[model samples]
Target: MGDDAPVVERVVESQLAAFNRQALDEFMECYAESVELRIDGVVAASGKEALREIYARQFSVAPVRADVVLRIRQAEWIADHELIEGAAGGPTMSVLALYRVRDGLIDQVQFFGQRVTE
Candidate 1:
């Protein structure tokens, strides 16, 4: 963790807010053009376009309505990035997100998540 931690955390926080609002464009603003994401150890998406496609599909399938609650349980800095863990409820899910932020934007993210039953 270093001074970059704050920048990393801010980007993650903004992105989470965007997710809660179901604002794809704002969500995308946090990422770099060449961003990459790995989901549960699998390389899920590469580049902004792919990211847009993936999230667009997600929102269309299960749009996060106003009632849905997206919460960030923690944001911890380790090395050059921040590890963000959270849950989205109203269909509860747990998520661990590793975000690599560089040059003031999220350059990469590794995500692991599971659906939880209440």
Candidate 2:
């Protein structure tokens, strides 16, 4: 682990807490202004404005929360295996997210997810 490992972990943890609380502003605080969000290698949202728009819509529709099942950290990167629930009445989702932290903020995130089926 590098010197910034704790910083990286704290940032991610804060973001997760903010997300679970639906605190958009607090959530955004953990992200960089030029943040990029990717879903399955495809860029979904770029910049804070876009992120706000996307998350706001989701927050308005339903209460969504993600529980981290596993986490791996190395230097400035953090990987999380998450189980997400309460997404607009849809089935729970199992998601793997890789976050890249820069200057104590998350500059990029790549997500891979699948709906859980019985």
Best candidate, lDDT: 2
Q: Which lDDT value does model 2 have at 39?
A: 99
Write the residue-wise lDDT of candidate 1 on 47-104 in tens digits: 9999999988877666553222342323343222222223222454555566777787
Which regions of candidate 1 are displaced past 4 Å? 65-91
- The models' CA-based lDDT, in order, is 0.68, 0.95
Residue pairs that clash (backbone atoms under 3 angstroms), model 2: none
Candidate 2 lDDT over 4-106, as tens digits, reads 9999999999999999999999999999999999999999999989999999899899999999999999889999999999999899999999999999999
Models 1 onward score TM values of 0.73, 0.97
Q: Which candidate is the best by TM-score?
A: 2
Which pairs in model 1 have colliding backbones?
Answer: none
